[model samples]
Target: MHLNDLSSCSSFTRRSFLRSASAVLAVGPILTEAHFARAAALDAAVPEFSMKGIHLDANENPLGPSEAARKAIADIIPNGGRYAPPLYFDLMKLYAEQMGVPVDHVQVYDGSSAPLHFTVLSFTSPTRSFVCANPTYEAGQRAAEIAKAPIHAVSLAKDYSHDVRVMAKADPNAGLIYICNPNNPTGTITSKEDIDWLVANKPASAVILVDEAYIHLSDATSAIDHVKAGKDVVILRTFSKIYGMAGIRCGFAIGRPDLLKKLMDYGNSPMPITGMIAAQASLMDSDLVTARKKLIADTRNDAFAWLRANNYSFIPSQTNCFMIDVKRPGPQIRNLMAQDGVHIGRSWPIWPNYVRVTVGLPSEMQAFKTSFKKAMDTPAAAFNEMPPLRSRRDGVVV
Candidate 1:
């Protein structure tokens, strides 16, 4: 609330990162690669819970947007009737300025997801492959599948860091290597040295796409400096995380101007003006990151401590989300918790035993701890490794 509330911070820029291309170009290649359980989760017939409980399914920031961002949105709404084309330019400039990079080096999107999907499409093809960690965010892998490009799902090392050296060797002809720092689902960090090694050893024509959607919550420094150094990296930044702008949906794809232009070729519509204005305001508020980080850090650390005391194993995390090993199928635990009016996140196919949990307000976390204890205390039905294939296979194609 107060300007003094924030922690010390700096303008985050891409000295380096990595990039993906387009969604359309990626579809045809991956149509057949399907997971039966994931397919069922995406089914239209799947019951939609009206979010009537503590919703932590997505890695959403419970803090929401800052007060400055809310004010900016309200002030800009009257002008929203007009095209306000210049707002796009203004937003990009503010992003570049904060990044200490040129305006051309940055491109804004409705949310980072657009560019995340697009980047895989733009750079990957049937001949070139897309590579990423096995239990990492699968959006990029889906994009690669769509592009009809081969996907190399490398496993994370024992310590949960992306096995960068192994990842570098994943596919000699890989067009894109995606790294989500503080990786989604797990919220574990891949080190800078590993990232540096990846950039150094990766195929020259290939690009490294870094998704820093949760960077601020962690202690790791931004790899944007490599982008600043003109490395073949495109970093994705989303206001959805620390800025609490998930609903507002503003995100950035920062890279060399040439790398970004490739994404434009696939085409995009005008951005939401309120999102642009709010994002700018969020950026200008120096204390926002610091304050939000402390709030999330305190909640997350406390929850981890509780899990440790109870002897429930969890992945060490630096972001707002972390995975808890519930000693059973994650989906079963997730559903049981949901029945108690406490919802959590889905499990990755690789780590079927671990369920992801998003950090929430202190009160919400307390609810989660209580609900989890009950969920775990009850005897769970045994789980099967291969779930029955979804009857509606048609829905899985996309």
Candidate 2:
């Protein structure tokens, strides 16, 4: 029967029930009425809250927009109608000076992701390749797929750090090497020495793309200095992280002028006027970065302590996020937490048993603790289970 006809019926007729049963049979055993009914029941049981319940999933700063940035955005509201302002060039100059690079070496984009995509598009081809850690940011790999470029994923080190040497050795013909420092999901840093070695040993024609999106939250060194040294390196930095301006979406790329020009040929136009203003103001408001870093560090440490106390296994992270081995499929635990009004982040297909959690305020961490404990208490048979393993190399599940 048609959907409308079924809805119009007050009760199921014998013929309709037979048709439904046949349709269900054709679908599969997994889609049984009982399974769907239980799913619906779980959905109905989930609590709905008005306020964002301890939003720790996305690694966003709970303390949002700095006063300086807010004021800059407010001051630029009237100039929205006008075409791109000269502030773009000024911001470039400021960032270049701060980074100790020439103005020609820096290019601004809507966000670091733009430069990242553009770089992949500009360089990689079917003949060329992209090399990255298995569980690093997947955006570049996705971009490579769009470009039909071959990708080589080197597993992370035993301590959940990027194995730069292994990545450098993966594909000598690689057009790009993408590294997310204080990597997403795991929030671990690849040592500067290892990265420097990669850059030094990489094929002369390849360009290394270093993503510093979370550098402000960690103690790790940045690769920006390598860019200034005229290496074939593109350092991507974003105001989205510590600046609390993810919504504003302002980020930049720093590299040798020649390499940056290649990326610019494929880059998008200037950023929005308001975003430019907010980014400049944020860069100038250094205090906000320091304060936010302290907040994240304190809360993250507390959460880590709790996890340790409870004998939970996790990658010790220096950034504002980290991955935990939930000892069961991550999606199952994620679903259970969502029912408790806590939506955690996703699990990678490669690391099905681990879930990445972002650091939020203390209260949010407390909520995470409670929800995670409850999730762990769930019956093993309730979720797709994995054997408890001590660790995986580079945090990649073997």
Candidate 3:
């Protein structure tokens, strides 16, 4: 039967007709012509894609999963058939001993992201607000949105480090303050003294949420010790970065027992047995952590030197990722490199001329260099032009 004739001749019941109409309307245009025009402008701003490219876009460890972690996962495969075991507590105890905090001070979860979300939900209510550095991880901002809490994003300092002073002053009634050490995108660290100053000067009612996702890669000290000292701080540590267990998805939060208990009111689910086993094994493999960290440091240093030699500006980084100032719109540069089989990172709306790149292996870095040069050598007239860059703050690009 012809589809047009079928639609015209079919007689339908009210419910059936409603359902068919709803199905068609569901996929109806949500984006207006103006929206498409804006999107096309954005697409023009981004780089082209290449199939054979190396991906350094996401800050993921190219060398993932230690041998021991893999073995532990294999050993625990049979246990997934059963309900989640009570290994989380045991793992907590091990982490406590290692970190020198009590078991009550630790909350294990699938990943640090859960604890981060829970912390935001638990602390920031409709009246209270969340304060964070601009250009930090967007997860906490998203959580505040879900909780209907206002978010105050203070711009980072000129050096790309968190301006704790400004952030503290911006939101006196902030319920939660988020600090990502070795801050994402820029890969810069805020000093411990600066953090201490923020804590000391912050509103007494506020709680500090320190995300140590990239701490192990940096030389700066952790705020975890402050948590142990009974500060109003909740420190999150993840096995994903240093242990190369991002896939396994295991991380924990360390804070005072009372603060930790508050997070539990949000409820805690049992940790995945396989994930638990992998985390425990990764923790045990101290040698693997040390070896991999050194490798990352050496490789990152080499990449930094190359960037300097090529006169590409970058934020000096202590972490496994850093931002390269491409002297053009980042999305455009990224697309161009993608076409050459090298996918780098997304652009920071705050830093339009910069592209963040993860520290890959030696060969991957070489590919990035080659792809980057090729993209730069190509004329600007060859690709679509993006809108003028906007800052995370009010200032024009320096």
The best candidate by TM-score is 1
Clashes of 1: 35
Off by over 4 Å in 1: 1-46, 381-398
Q: Each model's C-alpha lDDT?
A: 0.78, 0.73, 0.74
Worst 10 residues of 1 by lDDT: 9-18
TM-score of 2: 0.82
Put down candidate 3 lDDT per residue, 1-398, tens digits, no spaces: 12233333212211222332232211111211122212322443433333345767657787888889889899889878864434655576688889987666776777787778778887997888999998877667767877789989989998778999998887778899999998986789999999999889988899999999888888878887788789999998887787877667788888987776666556554567878888888888869766887999999999988878988888889888888888887767766775666777766567778877889889999998999988888798875563543222111111
Q: Which 10 successive residues of model 2 have the least lDDT summed?
A: 24-33
Q: Once model 2 is optimally superposed onto the true structure by TM-score, how far is the C-alpha of residue 112 displaced, in angstroms?
A: 0.8
- Candidate No. with top lDDT: 1
Q: Tens digit of lDDT per residue, candidate 2, span 119-186? A: 87777889889988878776677678767899998888998888988888888798998889989768
RMSD per candidate (Å) reads 7.0, 15.9, 13.3
Tally clashing residue pairs in candidate 2.
2
The clash count for each model shown is: 35, 2, 13
